[model samples]
Target: RRDTGVWDGRLGWGRLTHGRAADVLKNPAYAGAYAFGRAASSRKVRPDGTVVACVNRRPRDQWTVLIPDHHEGYVSWQQYLQIEAKLAANRTSTGARPPREGPPLCQGVIYCGSCGFPMSTGYRRADGTADYVCNRARSDAVTTPGCHSIAAAAVDAQVTRLLLAALTPEQVHLALAAADDLHHRHHRSHRGAELAVERARYEADRAERTFTQVEPENRLVARSLERRWEEKLAALAQAEAALADLAAARPVLPEPDRLHALAQDLPRLWDAPTTGAKDRKRLLRTLIADVTVRHVDHSRAHIGIRWHTGATDEVVCDRRTNRNPTQAVELVRSLLDTRSDAEIAGHLNALGLRTGKCRPFTVASIRHIRQQHAIGSKRNDPTGPGEITVPQAARILGVHEAAIYPWLRNGEMPARQDRHRRWCITWNPQTEDYWHNRVATSSHLKRTNPNYETGQAV
Candidate 1:
């Protein structure tokens, strides 16, 4: 619709400007109500002999010809008003407000329970992965923000499933009704355009007559009339061109059977990829007035949907994992020096903390968590990166720490002591290979037994 008839420049009809389109959409007449004296223009004379005019819209109560039920319209007056409010809410300039345009079904609807600010939408690296993030935890002094996010796919799926379950044929029927209205709307538009052309032609003719009838010596009045005539002709040409285009592009009315079939498959059509995000949102707004979401925890969100008819629906959608790594980092860093991996995991579970997959923490999970956050562990030597404690090395080597002590005293073992006097050894591939070779040659075995059994040295 942006470039409706741009096939060839000569015969093409350009689309309306953004401001003009918005004005047309916002007009109350489109909703069937007719009114007069809706706007007033005030002209101010400038110092340089130029006139400045400003138009101000008057309130509906001030209108002289206000009528509630003027004629049949595409939408009811109440619905038209709701659409206007929704449009205002959808504007990004309306900060921390609802009714935004986005793929995240709950983007504008969900407010942070903690700070009462509207959640914002973000996208993951992958396509179709949206995140509804609450950024209220942010502060000027603190570099780390307490903002939280939820995956959009799960939330959207839950909403869609719930919505489809609650919906009846009424929504589909309304859409069908709109389609029927559009077909009839063309007839009304054709008539209006024809009348406009007629009016413009008359004005053009009248101006031309006035210009011709003017005295030849009165050049000022003649020039003014000539300019008015030119303007009227231009208006007439525009109206005629629109009328021609409308006549040419008017669609043949679809058969009743096709409409019936389409209505029957309306649900399937709604689920189809052909239905765009904007249309889906519009359809949702028709039934759902507002949806409020509260983040109860990492995995769970309590959602409340308010329907226009004073009814409400509530449900909880839980994710399997927590995506925010900030919480895990802080928790693990505090517990690293005091607890073993298993003990730390137990503590995490006791605190009701879960991983990104929403699973209970395990020893390996704890180790991985510590590794990710650079937390020092018994298995992780603090001297250099990838260093292990003597006990850890002994376990890896399939021997006792006492065996490592003897080697350390004999100057055969390479190790370092930390501030706590705990021996640290680097366990690499070479370490394991050396242990395997020593075991193969029996160099690391205790000397005994053979002489005692044979009663002689062999």
Candidate 2:
């Protein structure tokens, strides 16, 4: 309770369940700071050839990094601290208690392979990990540790991958169709806003016409109509403002074409930050009813995912306990600085360095490895002294393929169309200099803003 100075120096409230309140405390919106760090840990080695970590609650004073006033807050920082303290004080409430809801992603559906009991979830303070722990030993009042402990992330991620991959082309097409219908539905759903503007305009126009028809000598009627006209003008302005506000607040839904493209891009959707955990879990729960996890040795887990369609998928997860692939990942990253995916794959293949097992190196395989590790492209360096493609130009220009396409589409930038209809861009000093210094500043689309920065056409 005293960890973050939120303790009131008294413990009276019952234990706070891990619910929406807990989720808020973990959120920076509820906290005045827009970041998270509550505790820290240090590792110590024992004399018996073993390593252990000692975790300690870090008072905010010892926190080396902090950013204040980073965002709009739901509450003051002090209030946030007080809430944390009050919640922490509830842990020691002495009594038989009702079971709280578990993590949203794996509640009531996950079972321990050893004891066949549902695993309980907790937030690991040291690493801020949502962990699932089987506490059969503790439940039976034994001194030994629980039978199993695993981070819910690895399991959840694997399940999500399976679900997304299982989307057949027909299903993808259907999803695209639904999204297209939704886009049209939402766009056409702006009738209320348009109606308000129409009504206001009619009233304004009628008021002005009446004012114009009235005689000036009839000051009584004249003044009344004038006042009425002013009121209508104000109302019209308000309605227009409201409409503008609605337009601004409305979400930008993707076009049907973009949605169709996205349906084929499952990995991008799965990896995007905007995809919420609850939504992912919901998708997973729809496809898969339950999952049974069994640990094999230290770094491997046997995963059995049971689908709702009476099918099962088995997977083996190699979760490292110490989990430092820093050196290996760094090697791949360094290679990415100079070598193409194919070149890196060939290089690795020649050196007898395969990923975990003896799998052959391929360009597609290397691409996945790079995406997983967040390695940037080496296309900027002009591989093998040949003419570059649009994708290569994009890498050299530090932009996307979309930005390069418009230039080629229009006659502004020089491009050669090969027999394969592929746009081949030749590397020239003049073109390179122009693109690096360029930023789009003018409208390209008829009714929308430009696609690139500074709004200039390609």
Candidate 3:
């Protein structure tokens, strides 16, 4: 019963609904504190000339009156504060993110060192590896270059090593002490539930005794007393059931010797198949307050670990190899000057070379790599030393580019198509004369003059 001997509009002795339970938890009065003006009411005029009243709950700082230790409480003030903190942390929006299920070790606790904001976890579809990216600029729609991103693997490995190192023998001893405290707390809570059950049983027995003592001839009094006894018996059963559940939910604590052995082999336990990502994250968050990471360069990243003990540690870890290997990029750059995108892709695939994402090279992928690295495509550049386009070949042979295409198609002229399927012919003084003679001797040939360099009009 939540009765306070006041005229509050509550039955104070019924099955509690979820909303009522939440209200009870949020009220500071239950924690031996007096709070006033926790909520504010306002009246607003609608467009239809109707007044609508609204009630908004205020923040703790905005409350009008608050007095600690105002009266006896169901829970201590410290427990109430802890409960509030936990509720705030569980909220996803505008609150600290709780540990979630994912492969990223520092998902919720990671921050961007550059912008000093929480980083978001993202996964690369190509390789399925995770990344921690500082998305402050993007999320806020600011006109600034976005902050850096670091691969999760390197940062996670470094933090894991640090965590294992911090778990020294002395630290294990302290952990055992914490475990002991937790066991005692659980025992005390269970005992409290048992005592409540005993009190409920006594209440039921007293109600039964009163019902038996009522006169059988007094029908009204006898019926009322019997009904009261039934209610008390029901309450006793509910209390006993609750106590049983509490006992069943209690965790079994390990012996000190076993805990020490497990602590010694902590690394193996962490990597065990039974361990899950969520479990690892929870364990990590217990010791680490937060981790800030920034990419120093392509090959290294700086990591800062802030522990729960107010101590901080910094480490530099080598970043994972770039998706596109240095050797692969160099090879692509070298081939871009001479080969078409298709030809380069083919050569790369033939040499057992894959892109940074470990996928076989494709024409589109090659083009993307070229554009990303600012390497010009062969088709975009003018003819190089021994190469000429169809237009150039046609100009030298005194024919239209369309006419040159026929010879190329018929294999009468040696040429190759670039990535876009445009013909490229080898051009030189000798090759030019050779094509001119071939054109002049062909029955399908036409010229402005029989003799070359006559400069005559058509």
Top TM-score hit: 3
For candidate 1, report its TM-score.
0.39
What Cα-based lDDT does every candidate model obtain?
A: 0.72, 0.69, 0.82
- Provide TM-scores for the models: 0.39, 0.31, 0.48
- The residue-by-residue lDDT of candidate 1 on 1-458, one tens digit each, is 14355653355356779987787668887788888989988999999999999998888788778786799877788888888887877676856344445666665666655566666788877444677777665543443233466777667777777677655456556655776898799989999999999999999999889999999999999999899999999999999999998997787766666756765676797789888777777677767767666767776877777887788888888743345256766877786676656777788888888886667888778777767666775544456776777766655555555767877667676777654345777667887799757755776554333444344653
- Per model, how many backbone clashes are there? 7, 8, 1
RMSD of 2: 33.0
Model 3 residue 6 CA deviation (Å) reads 28
Alpha carbon lDDT of residue 280, candidate 1?
75
Please estimate how well model 2 matches the true structure, expressed as its whole-model Cα lDDT.
0.69
Instruction: Name the better of 1 and 2 by lDDT.
Output: 1
For lDDT, the strongest prediction is 3
| Model 2 spans > 4 angstroms off | 1-104, 142-146, 168-262, 326-458
lDDT of 3 by residue, 66-95 (tens): 998999999998889888888788879876
Q: How many backbone overlaps does candidate 2 show? A: 8
